[model samples]
Target: MSDSHELSRRDFIKVTTGIVGGLIGAIIGLPSVFYLIDPALQEGGKDAWVPIGKFEDMQVGTPYPFSFTRVQVNGWERTASSFGGYAVRKSDSPDDLLILNSKCTHLACTVNWSAEAQAYLCPCHDAKFSMEGEVVDGPPPRALDIYEEHRISEDGIIEIFFKAG
Candidate 1:
């Protein structure tokens, strides 16, 4: 009877010890797992303000296509992505700058400025946008998307803010 009692006591301790160890591990592990997966479950990307160039570089009445690069952070990796847009300096005032995204609002195609046509033409869909990004003639649902956030620094540099989506 003594030997049997000792065996039962040891078995009960082993079972309780196993359950307690599992509970402790889950308490520490669940939060760590959620923290690692939070970014991946996010809905949208982030926005950043980047300085493209100086205001002096823009030519009045002409839409100049400009290229820029932005860095993206994901999980533990940093990557560089290139972006482009058109900057038009108003013919009347140098302070009046119109910035347009290079991608067409229709199909995300690159729109090229046509000097003769006097419009932004998308080669892929043949969609036309006027100087002010008004849809001229095409199947596009709307005009080109504009980069609304822009400012001139005290030093005359044009800073543009864009979102990565």
Candidate 2:
């Protein structure tokens, strides 16, 4: 009877050791597999200079909606979506243009240039921004983010770069 009990105890120890080893192997191997597969899955992951429109399409002091797609990659996958904004050419002086992000600094609401108020107004909370994108009143903490714009070729194609951060 003692010998039988000893054999049972040894079997239990072996089974528990095998189970623990399997779990450890799974934990270590899964991450390695993911790392190997990640880059291949992100074949199209790149930052692109999206074209807003022809430079001639925009006029000074007029804001028009611009939309573009941004592709992003994460562990083992690639994701893409369209992002848009109301881009404005504030001045035509010296061929320099000002591009303002449409998202209001306050509460992420859409800001519209109010001809009556003579300011960018957030309808959600009544926040106000000056024509230069400065926060004039309400809960906006800072000015709107300005985008860098460039004109490529004489065809008047306007391109803008957006940072993921």
Candidate 3:
């Protein structure tokens, strides 16, 4: 009877140790496993200069297309994505350039320049914005999104900083 009791006690300790070890392992390893699976869950927004290219190529009063890449991290996985938009050099006056985001403010639909209407039009909701990006009509609560832009040199090379929401 004594030997049997000792064996039972030893088995109980082994089972308890295994349970505690598994729990501790899960607590530490689960997050790492999740991070490895998705990296975007880790953090948001990295500051990077978006290149708009040679300023000489951009005609005054005309919208120029620019493209840039943004990295999204879920947990430990990172995905690279590209975004394209148009910018207009509205004025030759000092720092008079405007970078309009094509995304409509109402429901994030793409806004297109309506040359005939002389406005930015969002077909999804009929939102309209003036050439200057002011909200002229429709469901948009505010003006079209504008990006901060500055010329890298007097020669017309420009760089715009875009913040990812």
Q: What are the clashing pairs of model 1? A: none
Question: Model 1: how large is the Cα RMSD against the reference?
Answer: 4.8
CA-lDDT, candidates in order: 0.83, 0.75, 0.77
Highest TM-score among the candidates is held by which one?
1
Residues 9-92 of candidate 1 have per-residue lDDT tens digits of 777888789899989989989988998888878755578777877788788878878878777777688888777888887775
**In candidate 2, how many Å is residue 49 off?**
0.6
CA displacement after TM-score superposition, residue 107 of candidate 3 (Å): 0.5
The lowest-lDDT stretch of 10 consecutive residues in candidate 1 is 1-10
Native RMSD of candidate 2 (Å): 6.5
Model 2 segments beyond 4 Å from truth? 1-45, 71-82
As for lDDT, the candidate ahead, 1 or 3, is 1
lDDT accuracy of residue 58 in candidate 3: 74
lDDT of 3 at 148: 60
**The CA-based lDDT of model 1 is what?**
0.83
Candidate 3 lDDT, 10-40, residue by residue in tens: 7888889999999999998998888776644
lDDT score for residue 142 of model 1: 89
